[model samples]
Target chain A: MFGNIDRHTYITLSCVILEPNSPKISLARAGHMPFLVKQHGGVSVVTPRGLGIGLASAKIFDANLEEFSLELSVGDSCFLFTDGLSELQNPQSQDFGYEPMLDVLRSPASLSAQSIISEVMKSADSHAQGHPQHDDMTALAFIFKGTNKILSEYDSIPL
Target chain B: MNDVKFTIDHQSFGDVKLLKLQGYLDAHTAPHLESALGDLIQDGNHKIVVNFKELDYISSAGLGVFMVYIEDVRMTGGDIKLSEMKPKVFTVFDLLGFPMLFEIVEHDQIALSKFTA
Candidate 1:
């Protein structure tokens, strides 16, 4: 369905599905960076095999689309980002880079996943030195705080 | 501006020569290094050590420059070895799966020493 859309086309959509008995948080990527999983006081870069969203003809699975399970207990969070976050550069042409991103993740004030995303975006924006984005930037963060209310409030805080 | 800062100098470690780099290695400055290394390769100076004592960063594209010349240098019975990468840069190299591919060391003098040993 995505391949049919032209490159110049722009659309936004969102959906929610509640699967009560689904196995622990599962994510599968095709041609996408392995999303960042934050737990145990460490940031792990998750890289998956395959092409990005547009390459439908390319196989997303061999035998079956296996969802990589990440065990997320309460207080755990994950950040999914595109190339834009790391590619941003400052006036000096220095990349915002991964180290800074790690720093933001480790900051005490950045407790919630949404706060982490906001901090990451702000860091990228500031480091870009008022330069415009070179490409589309998108991030999705999921934080497990043991309940839905806490997660929703944390996710909705505007940047 | 390109972050890499280096002045051309020649040093002899036994029979090998070393060129030291002192800045970041990313898309912006990799071309300069590529050209320098290209010239050395053309001149048949295959035994080389790139001292990265001050290098703080590298991107995947920067890594490509070395990968492109690895086979050529080896075919000539010469090799390119890297040494003295700052921890930040080393982490990037490690993240990109380079430790398994390149000869990396922790000291500039020691890295140059590999060309002789």
Candidate 2:
């Protein structure tokens, strides 16, 4: 029932759909920042161009929208965040930026997702030099450990 | 520093409604924005351009307001456009991937013209 509205007033979002016990993840983008995946001592940014939800007609949005699948192995991790983390400014008014964040992601493979997230947040806070936060900082780190063999074994037991 | 406060100014360019925002847009101020946008939707004025030149900051909560309303406006054959965001303010939206969902222009005039196009 909606008519043609202006496109400027839309918001951007990124969503990841994961199947239980499956390594494959389906990601949909709506003008959000790229998520990063770390594997084999290398980090790759997943940035698929897509229009925002309200910026175009349904047909146009569908035509431009992209969905991609990723298979993660054990010890692989993905980092998702809003700009507040990378854009945090210091006393010199310099932003923390993306490079340092990539460096933070270079943590040892043995580190858990929680540990990596802590390190990332700590680094961002230190970079701020005690300046009061100007924007909200949010992030999610997903570390794949493959299928839970122990749980599977338990499931196989007669109950 | 001044305690964070937000204010909205309503203006019109023919059928397009413009809301100029000043100050920070965080959880506290997000409700005000939602109320303002809601009022516009109620009045059937869907063409909107939110000028953020005077806005100093935006949090995720502020961003959520746009997400909540965009679809409703679109369903009614109208749209909301954003314009004149400061680099910092824009970064917040960008960090959350808003550029993909919204048509962000550098100027109010540009956003205004999109309605005609």
Candidate 3:
């Protein structure tokens, strides 16, 4: 919606947005990567193929919007990261990929978004062994506690 | 690896300064370009013509930085323009769909003329 075909590289992007007052959170993917959702002792992967917007003649690719839901109790968390993290190559020239990522999640260390992201970056950096970040690194983790957990945490926030 | 070099020059076609980029705009070095443009925008110089005559490569993340700031630049009553992109970079641009949104020209003088006129 910004520019014509010859001026602006239009790589539109979309993601699953959780809204308030909705019965369930929604998930969508468009020319982007998947997000991780964790609940009830299990991990979920949500990735759909959508054309990267600005690629030449990428119109042939179809955009897909898919949703999956999980019942929540307490202490459930979701994680998301860009390829930079998954694709990070260690000093041994191997990727500190999904397995390590899952390991991090299994550990108790990945309870909060900031801590999870920081630890992942540190792990990747350590694996790289002083190699420059070949790509921009980004990560997001969301812990889903029940409504009671939300209220309790909210009540504790100092005004 | 230092295929592209950037420099800032003040031109008085009428009364504006021109900050020019003469290098590859790719992932490996785009952070510097982003910061340069960022500083200029922060300093309130909105009108810009990125002379891409010497530009060699650009990646999606590199493009993202521009897309991220384009709104801010336009909001300030300034625009980002392009000129003299080598065919190599243009191919990258065309492949990525950037040509559709940017003002790309074939010559540096033409880009400057557009800014003045």
Candidate 4:
């Protein structure tokens, strides 16, 4: 498959399939950052050992692929972001990094997924200190509020 | 935002070519890298080293450039050894597990030595 590309061209994907009225979701990743999960007042990352699609032979890519089923508790939140947030650099060339992003995820202002993204974006923007973003920065968050009310939001700052 | 800058400096040591990359490497700048590597491979110089000590950043697009040339060079009994990556630059590759596919060394000299050793 890679042969067709005059040069190496591949896609990085991180996907989660949701079920109706269920906390369980199917997840798959291809050369993407791990999903940031907020649970029990803490934050952690979940990533399977998967290489980017088209980066190697189908055999190798398939062998590395690992699909997972994750069940989140009602107050748990899941986030996936492009490197734009963590890779945000200040004038000094210091990146905002993941720790700060995790901090926001750990204790978002409110239970709403939008709040989670807003807090992180605000922090990331502050990290820039007037330095404009150079890459596409996208953030996604979903909160399993309950059987009826689920909050999710996607935000992006592209340059 | 301002335009991202990238440049490649190439030098040869025996059978291996060393390319020193500087500045940010993102989608807009990856083509330059593709051609730089493609040119070397076209010339039958497969053994190569990419020194990243000076590279400030690398997006997945830059990483994809490697996927394009790796198989070609390896088929000819040569390899691309990466070296001198900054912590941040390495993280981009590491997060995607590039270490498993490519040999990463601490210094450019270490990468060059591996070609002979």
TM-score of chain A of each: 0.70, 0.82, 0.72, 0.87
Write down the TM-score for model 3: 0.48
Per-residue error for A145 in candidate 3, Å, reads 1.8
Model 4 segments more than 4 A misplaced: A19-22, A146-159, B1-9, B27-32, B107-114
Residues B1-117, candidate 4, lDDT per residue (tens digit)? 223499899999999999999998988898898889989999999899999988988887788888877888999889999998998888788767687789999987888888899
Best by TM-score: 4
Q: What tens-digit string does per-residue lDDT give for candidate 2 at B1-117?
A: 223488899999998999999997877888889889999889989899999999987766688688767888889778899999998788667644567668899999999999878
lDDT of 1 by residue, B17-75 (tens): 68777666666777778888888888888888887776665665466677657667889
DockQ (C-alpha) of model 1?
0.03
Q: What is the lDDT of residue B37 in candidate 2?
A: 95
Better of 1 and 4 by DockQ: 4
Question: Which digits, one per residue and each the tens of the lDDT, describe model 1 over residues A27-142?
Answer: 66543444676666777766433323322222432322335666655666667666567767777767666676767766777777768888988888888878777656787766
Q: Which stretches of candidate 3 lie over 4 Å from their true place?
A: A1-14, A21-23, A55-63, A68-71, A148-159, B1-117
iRMS (Å) per candidate: 10.7, 5.7, 7.4, 1.6
**Which segments of candidate 2 are over 4 A away from where they belong?**
A1-33, A39-42, A48-77, A80-98, A107-118, A128-159, B1-4, B41-44, B68-77, B91-101
Query: A143 in model 1: Cα distance from truth in Å?
Result: 3.9
Which pairs clash (backbone N, Cα, C closer than 3 Å) in model 4?
none
What candidate 1 gets wrong by more than 4 Å, as runs, is: A1-36, A40-69, A82-116, A126-138, A144-159, B1-8
- Candidate 3 DockQ, CA atoms: 0.03
**DockQ of every candidate:** 0.03, 0.15, 0.03, 0.50
**Relative to the true structure, how large is the alpha-carbon lDDT of every model?**
0.62, 0.76, 0.59, 0.82
Residue-level lDDT for A126 in candidate 2: 90
